[model samples]
Target: MTPKAARRTVRIAMNGVTGRMGYRQHLVRSLLALREEGGLDLGDGTVLWPEPVLVGRREPALRAIAERHGLAHWSTDLDAVLADDTVEIYFDAQVTSARQESLAKAIAAGKHVYTEKPTSTGLSGALELARLARDAGIKHGVVQDKLFLPGLLKLKRLVDGGFFGRILSVRGEFGYWVFEGDWQSAQRPSWNYRAEDGGGIVVDMFPHWEYVLHELFGRVTSVQALATTHVPQRWDEGGKPYDATADDAAYGIFQLEGGAVAQINSSWAVRVHRDELVEFQVDGTEGSAVAGLRTCRAQHRAATPKPVWNPDLPATESFREQWQEVPDNTAFDNGFKAQWELFLRHVALDTPYRWDLLAGARGVQLAELGLRSSAEGRRIEVPEIAL
Candidate 1:
């Protein structure tokens, strides 16, 4: 290791480390992986140094996580973690409804903050968090994991290189059936079915899509959406049936800043019948591409063809061979881990990270607009938030 690399270390306090996304994605998968992997290079001679000190719901779970990851510190008290001088950064993977309160406390403690998407359940809370972070003068970021995915990264390269002439529109299909807690012993957490816990596709997934769309295309101007709860009753943690107050699915159409339009379907009640769990098809005037979790394909207009759509016509010709698979050019790792490295670098070296709290608030704005559109039964224009 370089002498300079050895000098810098970023101490992180992970909040909600025992939860699903918290434990798997934020702690073990992202921060711990970085710690085990040594470090990540940002540019120049700077490298990100991640040191995780786990904080979670249960003491036993937190201890197990710490021991398993070879981390020395574990805490059940959020206040103590915030007060610890060694913890320079406070990372939140807490439930959506709890994020605002936790973030407010963390910011008050004068620590840099990073958290999972949707920052908070509503625009007001998200805006408040943004204001608090700004006032605290600490670095803040939200996970925009899709932008860092290898397949999507390749697509971004194509777009930036003008491989796709003038972008037209994007279509995204995201989701799969999450088993009911009672019948299958619960695939997802019970909190995910309760509205009070901030559980819903529109709130959870749109933040991710907003970043992806904004990164690949342009800003969203307006949105029209339809949302529903397919499963009315779901089992809770106690194995008792509770009303599923949150939406299980959301279908939305967005008008981007430019004339380009996009549509996205997010659901927890759908079956996967495609290449991957989530897939996106991006079409531009010059070419088109289809990107999945594991693969990406590009199509040039010159090599593409028009086909007649007839009920009697074979379904195979339309989409089967329209695009060519783009070879994977980078080593693969967890997307959350990749973003974690970036955030660490941003904190340690003042790296130019664009995925800040303002961007996160924009996502909350879209989700709020989607809910408003669904509620009012009319298309709603998304208002811009000052970054």
Candidate 2:
């Protein structure tokens, strides 16, 4: 006979639900789906149910989204929501500049916090928020969604099993050509190209790279970065031209604490030639592997074919085909939802959650250092941040 499930609802005040990442990822993909699937099973019998109240500045958009998703609650006034006793958790996906202030408010209101990454515009701000959360004695977590990606998980498995011995280096290629919005509709929001609006490839993508590099190989010890604003002017959604003050591309080289070198090129101006929108290649002594969003391929030293340098002769060797595909032996869940479930469990069950504001601060630290490196035109040391 099946056992009965014990369930408890967690009321979460979700701010910035009207934005793109907020709506699609945190709301549609994660919270609503969790609500629809009943609740997460807690290994034993107890289950944690997610109850999200959409909060935003725009009442009409919030009401529409809430009504469409069959949500019972939404509010334009955050103060009123914070004062309510029912809201046990507060989540934010707001712009970088606004994150620290709102999250600080939530912590002061005695609510557990979960937020999207690059927690704040600066390391100090991020660290202050982390310190506040700790001082308030509330559970806190930051989204590190990329670590949960299926491809990265598989790569982690390989690393754990010693598939790649004595890892030498990592090469990450990410991005696609974003249309300048003059002749065609821009794929990304116009705010992404404006520095004043908290836009730039280094600030946007370096945080992700920081975590990925730290988790996969080791923590970054030093960084050398060069940033560029490829498209200086672009048309907005309303067909109005605007100056893009942020850097659209960043070329960075990092020295890992474990002595592994990692080079990453992040851009909105370059066309991709890889298998996915983003890809990472890890070269080691025993084997080499390449991982994308959902696919992973590897070649062991024994399987590697010898190739002689002969540019004069017609190249017949299929270098790409020499590598064998890694098997998908297990199923993977949606990254955003997985992290959400973990955060909910952390709040409800007192689970051990690792990705806290401190980790988020580290992400901000890397972005700060990367920007400094670019501005100074020299390699910058990454000092460990403590809160």
Candidate 3:
């Protein structure tokens, strides 16, 4: 008879459950889902269980979330939770401005930390947090969930297989029209458009671009960007008008290591014309591929179609139909949940996990450089961070 696996319950103090990404992705989809599955099998003699202690500023909201999820633990005080020795891990999904202080507290409490990115509002603060986590000798990580998406996973597979030999360039388009609150209620929080609240497309998205480019291709060597606040006036949640001081749109050109150029446009003012909300097109010597959040398609050099550029005639080529869909060889789980399991294992078993706070600082660094480039109206070289 086979022996039963040992079960270990890990209490994680989760902050910012009131937020959209925190509630939906981290709590419901990831942690709670893991609990429902009877915890994660650690591929050894043990099974790792996740017990969440919901933390936030509002008691009512925290209590409501805890009750809805059949959880007994919820706290309005972060310090109270941090003081508990049983809470081995502290996860932060708070607003960008509030993140650094809370993370510092968690580190001070000797709790392992995992957090959402652009880890801090600025690069210096982010690096400080990273340094603190490193000195504390605690397991730490930042959310880089997009890398685990089905499309990016397939793209990684293609890269690993040398399908796109000598990768030349990458173009990325991301964003959608965020409704103004007056006529139609805003889709995002009002704070997202307020500069005082640490809001901007460059700050929000350049972090994502930084990790994606660095991990898949090479490190970003330089940046040229234009950040703009297209929608100047916007109504808040209370139907009150306010100045939108943050950049709603950002256009950037990044030079990657190995001479690859990447151009990405991120905007909240754009209408969708592509198949997905976000898409990246990569062109190489041997082939080219386009990938979105869930799908990836590739066209080999042999299958490339050529069309004569004649202004007088309408084009006859079905350019969209020419690409072949990349098959999902294996089933994909939710990206947030996947990373959660990995972090849990890293905590329980000391597994190899590389996406730490330092990696997160790199994201913040790119965001800062991108914004600086826009402000200075010139290309800015990315400096390597050491700590």
Candidate 4:
């Protein structure tokens, strides 16, 4: 709203803004915050304003979110919103099942597409959407927020600096116990436990792992996985017991394009005992580094202490103390907001973007392969997705 010199406004049809990820990360933290800062500077003195039009099914929730953010536009009718020529982009944050249908409609309606990951549960559906978007010749993107995370950024810096020398392996531990809704309200929605609603740990986390692994190291070539429903029964939001048909936990071993190996364990049934809810420890020839959500620590090979195999006896040395903490030399912005700005710039200034619909399809392919590996009880080779 600042009096800027000839700023252009990009009207974004933000579908599924009633959901948690959509509202908290996209609407509030990213879009509204950008608006509050007087929009984005395009580096040539002209600013790019992002005007988000909230679209959802529930009238009350949609009205509430829009009013709280002081947004002027919102509607329950998606078709009507898409019909408006002013709407340039359609962003989807809904369930995985709805991604293909919603995106196909948006692409057909001549609107650019942007969305959260796991574009579809099946590889075929995801590929179809990607091809559709490509055929439409409109701009598209998927949220790959982890790549812009501070801890991951620090790790990337170490890699770029050749601190790792030759990378060997990556071990990722991600999980936290979700409280059952019987005595305590569940943090996640009840539908997340149902397979019918396109909910599962492998589908959810594999998308993140795909981008993380691809961005940090290389492309994932194969996967060997075991997925299970740790907590089969849990109370729903309405205080009624429901069968948790979806897998709440997944253990995976991945083979990257390089000789390096990667293992990731994702679960919602386990308690947190490590440095953070999600942490990745990468080992290399020269050193090893462990990165959490906001921090990273590294230990050089020369500094590694020799430990005697005396597990039966009391420990003597502090293993964790050997690594030095990496300092925050620069302010880390919100990952989602940063990506949003980039996407805006991509739309406005025709900047290069890598996280397109094809990238999202790759995520879907990984999740599908992981599930297949679990079901078939074997390692599945990940083939390159071609249009």
Off by over 4 Å in 4: 1-4
Candidates in order, TM-scores: namely 0.94, 0.98, 0.99, 0.98
| Model 1 per-residue lDDT tens digits across residues 356-383 | 8889999999988898899888999887
lDDT tens digits by residue: candidate 2, 196-273? 999898889999999899988999999999999988999999999999999999999999998999999999999887
Better of 2 and 3 by TM-score: 3
- In model 1, where do residues sit more than 4 Å from their true spots? 1-7, 41-48, 313-318
Cα lDDT tens digits for candidate 3, 187-304: 9999999989999999999999999999899999999999999999999999999999999999999999999999999999999999999999999999999999999999999999
Best by TM-score: 3
Clashes of each: 0, 0, 0, 0
Model 4, position 198: C-alpha lDDT score: 94
Lowest summed lDDT window (length 10), candidate 2: 39-48
> Candidate 2, clashing residue pairs?
none
Cα error, candidate 1, residue 228 (Å): 0.5
| Quality of model 2 by C-alpha lDDT | 0.91
lDDT per residue (tens digit) for residues 250-323 in model 4: 99999998878999999999999998899999999999999988899999989888889987899988899989
What shift in Å separates residue 122 of candidate 1 from its native position after superposition? 1.3
Judged by lDDT, which candidate is best? Answer: 3
Question: Is 1 or 2 the stronger prediction by TM-score?
Answer: 2
